[model samples]
Target: LSDPFVIIELLPRHIFSSCVEQQTVVHKRTLNPVFDECFEYSVTLEQCRAEGAMILFTVMDHDVLTFNDFAGEAYLSLNQIPGVDRGTSNADNFHGLKEIELNLMHQRDREHPILKTLESRLGDKAAQDFMKKCRERVTNF
Candidate 1:
């Protein structure tokens, strides 16, 4: 088993590709990790809903010498998240939803750069199938 952490990438409208990024502390040697981390990005409501806005959650293994391993990832639309799509007010902020659980998954395409790398290291069939099941099971409300 390997230590794992989470990386959050936020791309707002007209912003550079690598604008805002955050990461959670590494959790050692566990498949299920619990993280109590917070991230804040200053973006207006209009920017949040813009077509260029994208939120990516990437799960990676913490490696010391070699490159980190990609476990899974999920693409989140800020518009789909509850309370985020609401009007510009305190109510829209993620206040009561302190323990929001988002399930991240591997990308579906075998040709995807991350997934390709993951498959090459972990073998193709089993890992890809597992990821497909995870994606189907996750329900965003």
Candidate 2:
């Protein structure tokens, strides 16, 4: 298992195909590419203090030739979807919501054995009421 502090790529969107028009950079840092050339990567942030916490970030990719540099970057102008994750907010963010939760839910998915057992033990009426309360809680979030 990877250490918590050992930051690493969580997705394959780290690398992309762009037309290299400039110099002869020769180091392959691409995720799956075996090319003879790879760009020299570096980070040059001076200061990033958040609530007295010193932060350090890195330059994941930089394409000087394209106008879409912010394509893979974070954008904060989107609205949050409700009843999806108990919702995510900017203050604490949706940091607790996992990938699967954020990607929408499967309506017709089979129930787990635990869920079946609980439904049997709790009775359908009680389970329905509990689920209704859950949905209400999510909606009110």
Candidate 3:
């Protein structure tokens, strides 16, 4: 870690690791509330190693004793693939920005109450493609 303070500046959401001291070069990525909170993370460790981040620690998902506590062993698996932050969009509009939001939400909640309506409303396929990619990325991790 550059500085304990600098690590805070990183605001690591999709990740947490003891390897911060090993000089982690975090990838730029967005955050989503639902997936970020739900699953134990499996960010790619190989990418960070390729990017010059050496592992000093790790935390495995299954070893994560509680909802939050994970084995430090898995912390070495810190690299993340790009654009995998949120799996599927759950927004609500996309003929425009409004519709785009709806498109994302609909994908996120293909079965949500309000989102059923939003899915019915969107016309573009692009957002769905992106969301599909998101789902695949999430599955891979």
How well does model 2 score by local distance difference test? 0.27
Worst 10 residues of 3 by lDDT: 1-10
Q: Which residue runs does candidate 1 get wrong by more than 4 Å?
A: 12-18, 86-93, 98-101, 112-141
- For model 2, residues 11-92, the per-residue Cα lDDT tens digits are 1121211211123332233433222333422311111111221111111233447321111112111122222223443333
* lDDT of every predicted structure (CA atoms): 0.67, 0.27, 0.29
Q: State candidate 3's TM-score.
A: 0.17
- Report the C-alpha lDDT of model 1 over 35-89, residue by residue, as the tens digit: 7787877766667767756687888898899767778887777776664566544
Model 3 lDDT tens row, 98-138: 21111121123335554344435457464454345334423
Q: All candidates' TM-scores?
A: 0.63, 0.18, 0.17
Candidate 3 at 59: error in angstroms? 15
Q: Order of candidates by TM-score, top first?
A: 1, 2, 3
Candidate 1 has an lDDT of 0.67
Instruction: Identify the leading candidate in terms of TM-score.
Output: 1
Query: Which residue pairs collide in model 2, if any?
Result: 27-38
Q: Give model 2's TM-score versus the native structure.
A: 0.18
